[model samples]
Target: MLKTALGRYINNFKGFTHEVWILALITFINRAGTMVLPFLSKYLKEDLQFTYGEVGWIMVSFGLGSMLGSWLGGKLSDKIGFYKIMIFSLFTSGILFILLQFVTTFWGLCFAMFIIMAISDMFRPAMFVSLSVYAKPENRVRALSLVRLAVNLGFTAGPALGGLIIIGMGYQGLFWVDGITCMIAISIFAFYIKEKKKTSINKDNIVLSDLPKSIYKDKPFWLLLFISFVTFMVFLQIFSTLPLYHNEKFGLSEFQTGMLLSINGLLVFLLEMPIVSTLERKGVNKIKNIAYGCFFIAAGYFILLFDSWVGILVISIVLLTFGEIFSFPFVNAVALSRAPKGQEGQYMGFYTMSFSLAHIVSSKTGLEIIAHYNYQINWLIMGTLGLLALLCCFWLNELVHTKKKS
Candidate 1:
């Protein structure tokens, strides 16, 4: 009976096509080399002696670039398709990383960082489009979960390895390694994966008047988008403020901080796919699952309020990981489900822009809060925001349900 259970568990991973696996592999390779951005705030403060305000602005530049990139990538993918955009994004962004290593001045660094983030982020919408195109509708969420699994697995390795690289070779080594891995991902895509051919639509049957309305005009989607932006604003603090918080409050080293960050990835790697699959099999509602995720995220932040102990930190991360597992992949699935036929890229792009928008506000505002007050207040604010986001999720659920009934 135990062996039969084990076999069933193993079989849960078996149904995706070769292209989906390739996409997962590419995600793995790129994310494994994700060394620079996670460490950028630390590098700027520790190495370059930048002030907190300056670091905030630098991150703002990155956010602006990310927002613009998502918009442009979505628009361009709709026009030219995902393949060309993916290839260009990977190759050019890799080269920009190599160039970024040489930039010393603050403005120069900002300019380079902006371009690098913009180019690198273009991959998001293209990848989302590719996932929808390659996977069957029934399997798309599971396919995306596989990709997320690869991402977390790679993330599990990247920061730990990056810590060692930082100790041995300094910050420049991070850029070189990241650039090389991006090229490796690019090669995998160019050689192994052929873009899915667009199915031809008959012009006679296609009513120009019946084309999907612009995303701006879609009220429900916009509401969902707003909720996404708010949730991400809370969620993204893990990247922006949490690192600095760890350093300041707990006096953690770079390696220690990296390990702390990796805990979230480790938990997700171990649990997310199985949980999501099991939940789906049990016929759990995705929207309710997401609401639960929001609550857990808030709980994670709330936990941080009591102490700076290592044990508490670990528990906080665990809660946050559960939140991520429940929320992120399902959110993507919902966004894809809502998109009109032939407009996947545009919808995905807008979906991605929500996170980019969060980056802009989360980092800068988080730092400003920390600069003025304390980490406790920051956590409190984020936890409160998470509760607000939970309410938004419930509203979104009703909105979607109403639309379907209509």
Candidate 2:
């Protein structure tokens, strides 16, 4: 019985095309080298001796660049194609990563960071477009789950490796190592993956147009985008504020913090694909799952309010990981499903833009709250935001169902 179950579980990972696996590999390789963003706050605070507010502004700069990148990436992917945009993004971003090591001044560092993020983030919409193009409709969610698995697995490796590098060669080494990995990913993508041709007709027999389109006209998608933006604002606090909180509140070292952050990725790596597979097999309602996820997210932040104990911190992170596993991949699946043919890049770009906007809001507002008030207040705000997102999830479900009925 056990063997049969295990075999079935393993079988869930199969059936994706060669291109899907290649895309997943590319995501893994790129994410594995993502050392800089995770430790940017620490570097700014400790090495650069920047104030919390300054760190926030620097992050905002990166966020602004990322926002623009997402928009441009979508437009360009529609116009030129995913392959060229992705190739250019990977190669140029790799070069930028290397150049970032030379900047010491505040403004210069911010400018460099902005450009680096803009160039790097252009890969996101293109990658998603590629995923939608390559995988079968029924397999789309699973395909995304596979790519997300690679991302989390790579994330698990990146920060842990970054911790060791920080100890051995210092922060400068992180940039060089990250850049090298980007170049390697570029090589893999360039040699292995071919560009997929766009389909001119969708399933509904709606003719796809090459002319400029307006995504803003889709009311339900706009609502989804709003909900996503809000949820991301709360979710992204982990990247910017949580590290600072752990360092200051618990006096933890870089290695320890990296370990703590890695917990989210590790949990997702272990459970996300299986969970998503199981849920799909069971015919679960995606919106209801998202609502549950939002509640868990709120609970995670709420846990922090009661105590600063390491055990509580562990519990909090575990809860947040649960929320992430339940919600994020499905969210992407929904976005992909809703997109009209020939507009995948636009839809994905806007979806990605939500997170980019959240980076700005979370970093700037969160750091300021910490600088002015307290961590407790920040936690309260995050929890409240999560509740709001939960409500939005319910609303989104109703709207989608109503549209189907109509």
Candidate 3:
């Protein structure tokens, strides 16, 4: 009977539109490569014997490249096409992954990571563009939710697999596996996925700048982007610093760290949408949700300042994950709704820049904090930043509400 219920659930998922499924598959594969990142600091520090400063520099290199890529990728897609941009991004990032096998020096790894991040980020703007083209307006939220599910599922398996590979073969072997999987993903996309084309009549009616400029003028629109930057700063810490903290502070093994990260993703996979619905039903504005998320995030890390047991560590992560789901989707939904009638692609491109900025800041900031102070001190500081973010959200709520009433 339980098997029958699970089967029904699986079938329901499969019944989504073909475009949504295609995007989901592509997202899954891309995210599989991405999941290795959560453990990268550990691999670098342990296997390569790199200093915290060097590790921080490497991440900053990638962030710098990604920032440029995010802005250009959107405009490029507008000039070329989303399908072509996606293919380019996949193959280019795959090659960079394969090249990681040769890097031993700090500068070499930085160069390779920067190239990989820049090219891979080219896909970011295009994904939203293609999704807008494919999904009906009414079905877009569900379509995006399914794609996010694929990301979580992919990470669930990928990081665990990455941990095993690192345990058995070391970091080089993990990079090789990532490169191979990415190549397979590219081939699958090229051979099996169909591109959804915009009708010429529809294209003829719209000017390229019309949509982008309109979105820029909306005050709430830019405020949403700023909040995204802050959220990413908080989120990136999970990937870039937390693993290092676990290794140094708690003396966690690679496998154990992988399990902890997996727990964070698992809760999102299971409960994100339900929580979003609950908050929305309670008449919570997006700003309020973002504010509450920030507060909880701060509190969770503060809780960690005192935690010594693995079990308590797990609880802190659970608290952090709840904040993540609330802030992430709520921010995206608010931005998407505020986008001009036909400018989702442009707005999403602008939106992605926030991530680029956050990555840059977190990579550099996290490393500096660890080097100058200590891991515990760094955590405390980030907790403080979370409070600042909460305050920003309240200011944002007032701004958005006033704009609406006007």
Candidate 4:
């Protein structure tokens, strides 16, 4: 019975198409290469003797890089082309990671982190834009979900694997591994992945003014974007403070903390797609799912307030995972649905930018709090903000429904 069930699972894996698998493969490589940093806070604090304020500033620099990169990458996608932008981003990011080997000072590390963060964030909007262009509307969610799965799986493996590397080879080995993997990823994209639309085939320039005003004028989309913005801001702060919390308050090791962070990715890897499909079929409104997600995430963060052990942590992880599955995909789907025909790339740019902008602001805010006060208060404030964002999601849903009716 066990063998038969295992065989069936293997069959399902084989059933995935070449294109889909290729997309997932490249995404996995990219994410795996990038996973070094989530656990780097512990390294910096313990090994390098950096203070909380120093780490906060370093993180904020990364956020600044991401904010600028996401914005420019979007515009550059229009001017230079998506695939080309991706090529530059992947290679440049790899080079930056390798450059980290020589860095000793806090300033040097901050600069390196900035370059690495910018290039990696730039790769994403372009990649997603390409996915939107290539995949059919009906299959888009599934395709994106596959990519998401690759990311989470890579994230799941990367940190746990990274923990071992940190243990055996030291912190610098993490960067060396990441840099080499990035090169491999770039090579795969360069040789294997072919764009559906060749840039050279189109000479006609698409002006920003020619784009749909719906992105600006559509109240529902705006509301949705705004609500999403707030929640993302709240959520992104967790990464900035959580490592410090575990180290100071709980005395958790890098491996243990990495394990905790990995739980978030592992949950998404196991369940995002099945949940998306089931909820889509169940007549559950997408916005409701998103709102519920925010509620759950907030609740999960608040649960951390009680200082529970593994069992309670598992419960909190479950809540945040469900929230991530529902909210992340729903927001993306809504953005795609709202986009003007043939301008999917542009819309996805703005869509991604919303999250990027939120992340930058939130990280900066979290840095300020940690700089001034404590993690306990910062987490509480962030959790409350998430609840407020959940409330806004209901208003966003009403607007979308009204617009659809008209």
| Top TM-score model | 2
Please list all clashing residue pairs in model 1, or write none if there are none. none
lDDT of 4 by residue, 1-406 (tens): 9999566434434334465677788889978877576766666666788886777667667777776677667767766678888888888888888787677689987887777777777877777777666665566766777788888888888877887888899888888888888888878977887756623323265444434476567667677778788778876654666766776777777787778768989888767877776676576898898898899878877887777564665676677777778888888887777665555556667777778777667766776787788666777887898899898887887766775576
Compare candidates 1 and 4 on TM-score and give the better one: 1
List TM-scores for all candidates, in order. 0.95, 0.96, 0.89, 0.88
Ranking by lDDT: 2, 1, 3, 4
Tens-digit per-residue lDDT, 235-336, candidate 1: 888888888888888888878878987888888877888888888789788888888889999999999998846688888888888989998888888787
Q: C-alpha displacement of 86 in model 1, angstroms?
A: 0.5
- Please give the lDDT score at residue 44 for candidate 4: 68
lDDT of 3 by residue, 1-406 (tens): 9999566445435435677778889788877776568877777777789988888888888788887777778778766778888888888788788787788899988887877888888888888777777776655655666777778777877787778888788778777777777777778888877766643436566565434456657776787787778777876788888887777778888888888888877887777655654555576777788887888788777877785675767877888887887777677667666665445556777888789889889978988988888777877887888888888888888986775576
Please provide, for model 2 over 2-28, each residue's C-alpha lDDT reduced to its tens digit, 9 standing for 90 to 100: 999788768888899998988888789
lDDT of 3 at 65: 82
**Global lDDT for candidate 2?**
0.86
Worst 10 residues of 4 by lDDT: 198-207
Question: Which residue pairs come into collision in candidate 4?
Answer: none
- The list of candidate 4 runs beyond 4 A from truth reads 1-17, 198-214, 308-310
Global CA lDDT computed for model 4: 0.74
Cα lDDT of all candidates, in order? Answer: 0.86, 0.86, 0.76, 0.74
